[model samples]
Target: MAATGSVALALYYYYVRGETQRGQFVGLWPATILGLAVSLNLEQMKRMLQDFQN
Candidate 1:
């Protein structure tokens, strides 16, 4: 959801506001957030598996 919002905002900035540099900067945000989410989820799943084994 957050990633989608970031993309939308980036598009607005690029097309409507005419800020290419800023738009490109904002565009990177979604990938960063998604990477972080994946890492966190993997860590959480590992912990859950360990707990189940105990």
Candidate 2:
């Protein structure tokens, strides 16, 4: 949801608002958000597995 919003805003900035640098900066957000989400989920799964074993 947040990533989608960021993408929309980025597009708006790039096309509608004509802020290329700002748009490019905002465009990087989705990857970062997804990367963090994956990292956190992996950490959570690791903890769950350890808890199950113990």
Candidate 3:
């Protein structure tokens, strides 16, 4: 959810004004990095949870 929100925000910034809350870094680059991180974390956490379940 966080990853998706970040990506969606980035896209909106890029297409809408090419800027974001924290400037270009926030607008796209960092957002992308954070999105990737969040997504990977979610995936990893999901796997860990599944492992625990099993």
Q: Predict model 3's lDDT versus the native.
A: 0.70
Instruction: Report the lDDT tens digits of candidate 1 across residue range 1-54.
Output: 999999999999999999999999999999999999999999999999999999
- Candidate achieving higher TM-score, 2 or 3: 2
lDDT of each: 0.99, 0.96, 0.70
Prediction 1 TM-score vs. true = 0.94
Best by lDDT: 1
- Candidate 3, residues 20-50, lDDT tens digits: the string is 5634444455556787888999999999999
2-52: candidate 2 lDDT, tens digit per residue: 889999999999999999999999999999998899999999999999999
User: Which runs in model 2 stand beyond 4 Å of their true positions?
Assistant: none
lDDT at position 40, candidate 2: 100
Query: Least lDDT summed over 10 consecutive residues: which range in candidate 1?
Result: 12-21
RMSD, each candidate, Å?
Answer: 0.6, 0.7, 5.7
| Candidate 1 local lDDT, residue 43 | 100
Pairs with steric clashes in candidate 1:
none
Total backbone collisions for each predicted model: 0, 0, 0
Prediction 3 TM-score vs. true: 0.51
* Model 2 deviation from the true structure expressed as Cα RMSD, one decimal place: 0.7
